[model samples]
Target: MNLDFPTVMLIAAVITGMIWALDAWLWAPARREVAARKTASGGVSKADLKELNKEPVLVEYARSFFPIIIIVLVLRSFLVEPFRIPSGSMIPTLMVGDFILVNKFVYGIRLPVINKKIIDMGKPQRGDVAVFRYPKDPSVDYIKRVVGLPGDRIGYFNKTIYVNGKPVPQEIIGPYFQDEHPLSQSAELRIERLGNGEHQIVVEPGASLVEGQYIVPEGHYFMMGDNRDRSNDSRFWGVVPEENLVGKAFMVWMSWQWDQGGVIWDRIGESIQ
Candidate 1:
C-alpha cells in the first residue's frame, strides 16, 4: 500500500493528543479523587490506593508520544524535511541514492496532509532544484530544475534551451560516466546557465531528441531535469502547478549507491546546487 507519511503522522498526533488531553481533563482527576476518598475512608490498603491512582497504560503512552509526534510533524511540514532520491534524473547534480534536505518554508508554509499553503514566503527561481508533487499523480513526489517561470516561453532544440527567445548558454565540460548505468555510455557533462546560477547537467548526444517549445501558464512552472535526455519531466507530462510545489532541495545529507559501493563518504553534507 502507498501510505502517506504526513497523513499518518497527523492522525497519530491527533489521537495521542486527544487521549492525553482526555486523561488530564477527566480520567486523571477522577482517579485522584478516588485515591483521596480511599485515604480518608482508611479501609483500602496503601498499595491498592496507589494502584487506583496510577494512570492507564494507553494514556501514559499517549502522553509520552504526543509531544514528540507534534515536534516532528511541525519540523517536517514547516521547517525542513528529508527525502531520498530514487532515480538519476538529476545526474551530475544529485545521485541515485542521495538523501537530501528540502527547505519546507522556503517556498511557503503549507498545512500538512492537505498541503494547502497558509503563508507566502517565496517562489521558485529559474535555476532552483525543486521538489514537488507530480501533477499527474499527486501522491508521487518529483524533483527537477525550474526552467521557465509563469508566462515565459521555453524551447528545447538540439540539446540547447531557449528561454523567452534567448538561448541559455552551455559550456561543454567533458565525457560523463555514471556508475549506475554501465551499459549506456554516450553522455557528456556540460555547465548550463539557466538564470542567475549555473549547474552541471548530463546530456546524451546519441539519445533520441524530443524537441518542443512551450509557454508556461500563470501559477504554473516548467521543470526539466539535469539529465536532459534521460529525465521524465515537463517535456513528457506537463508543467507543475503552484499548489504542487513542496520545497527547494538545499543539501544532500547522505549518499549510498548500494549497487556500486556501500556509503559515499565524499558526498555527505554537500550542498545542492
Candidate 2:
C-alpha cells in the first residue's frame, strides 16, 4: 500500500485530540473528584491514586504531538501544501527533487483526500501550472499546465498546440540542454504564450505522444507537460475533472541534485509561472 503521510497525520491528530478532549471534559474531572473522596475517607493511598489517574503512554505521546499535527493538517488542507516533484513532465518549469509550495485555496478550498471543493473561490486559467489527482488513477498526483479550459476545443498536431481552432503562438528558442536531466538528455525548447502567462516548453524532433484533437469537456481542464514529447498527461489519458484539482504551484522553495551532491541553489526560491 502507498503510504500517504498527509492522511496519516490527519488520523493521528483526530485520534489524539479525541483522547485529550475526553479526558479534559469528563474523565479527568471525575478522576480528581473520586481521588479526593477516597483520600478523605482514608480508602486509597496518595501514591496509588496518583498512579491510577496517570495517563497511558500512547495518550501521553498523542497529547504531545496532537497540536503540531492539527496545525499541519489545517495549513495543508486550506492554506498551502508542500510537494516534491518526482518526475520530469514539467521540465524547465519544475525539476525532479524540486520541493514546491502549492497554493491550496487558489482553485478552491477542498476537503483533503476526497478533494471536494466547497467554496467558489476562483477558476483556473490557461497556462496555469496546476497539481491535481491523476484522472487515470486518483491515488497518484500529477502536475501539468492548463492548456484548454471548459468548452474550448484543444488540438495537438505537428508538434504544436491549438485551442478553439486558433493556433497557440510558439517561438522556437533552440535545443534544450541541462547538466543532468532526470528524464532525457536533450530536446528542442520554445516559448508558448497563452494570454499573459508565457512559459518554456521542450519537444523532441521526431517524438510524439498521444497527440490528437479533443473537445475539452465541461468543468474539465486539458493538461499538458512542458516536456511535450515525453509527457503522459491529458493527451494520453483525458481531461482532469474540476473535482480532481488540488492547487496552483506558485513557488519552488528548494531543489536537489540527486546525481550530483548538494542542492541546485539557483532554482531555489524561484517563482513558478
Candidate 3:
C-alpha cells in the first residue's frame, strides 16, 4: 500500500491525544474519587486501590506516546520533513534512494492533510529544488527544480532553456561516468548556471529534445527535473500550482541501495542544489 505518512501521523496524534485527554479529564478523576470514598468508608485494601489505579494497556500506551506523536506531527507539518528519492529523474543531483530533508516552514506552514497554507513566509526561487504535491495526483509528492516563476516566459529548444527570450546558459562539462556503474552510460554531465549557484545536470546528447514554450500563470511555478530528456515534469504534464508546493529540499541526509547492497556513506550530508 502507498501509505500517506502525513495523514497517518495526523490520525495517530488525534486518536492518542483524545485517549489521553479523556483519561485526564474524566476517567482518572472518577477513579481517584471512587478510591477516596472507599478509603474513607472503611479499611480499603492497598491491593484493591492499586488494582483500581492500574491503567489499561491501550490507555497506558496512548498516554505515553501522545506527547511524542504530537511533537512529531508539529515538527513534520511545520518545521521539516524527510523524503526518499525513488526515481532517477533527478539523477546527478538527487540519486535514487537519496534521503532528503525538506524545509517546510521556509515556504510556509500549512495544515497537514488539508495542506492549506495559513502563512506566507516566502516565495519559491528559480533555482530551488522543491518538493510538492503532484498536480495530477495530489497524494503523490514530487521533487523538481523550480525553473520558472509566475508570469515568466519559458522555452525549451534544442535541450536548452530560454527565459524571457534569453537562453539560460548550459555548458557541457564532459562525459559523466560512474566507475563500474554501467546503468548511467548514456548521459553526460553538464553545468547549468542558474540563480546564485551552478549545478550539474545530466543530459543525453543527440537524444530527442522535448521542446516547448510556456507562459507561467500567476499563482503557479514551472518545474523540471535535472535529467534533461529523461524527466516527466512540467514539460510533460503542467506547471505546479503554488498551493501544491510542500517545501524546498535542501540536504541529502542519507542514501541506501539494497540492490547494490549497502549504505552509501559518501552521499551522506551532501547539500542539494
Top lDDT prediction, candidate number = 1
151-220, model 1: which lDDT tens digit per residue? 9999999999999999999999988985575425778899998889899999989889789999999999
* Tens-digit lDDT string for candidate 3 (60-97): 99999989988998999999999999888787899888
Native-structure RMSD, model 2: 2.4
TM-score, candidate number 2:
0.90
TM-score of each: 0.97, 0.90, 0.94
Summed backbone clashes in each candidate are: 0, 0, 0
Clash count, predicted structure 3: 0
Full-model lDDT for every candidate: 0.93, 0.86, 0.89
TM-score-wise, the better of 1 and 2 is: 1
Go through the candidates in order and give the C-alpha RMSD of each one to the true structure.
1.3, 2.4, 1.8
Could you give candidate 2's per-residue lDDT for residues 222-247 as a string of tens digits? 99999887788888888999998989
| Order of quality (lDDT) | 1, 3, 2
Off by over 4 Å in 2: 1-3, 41-54, 182-186
TM-score of 1: 0.97
Error of 2 at 206 (Å): 2.5
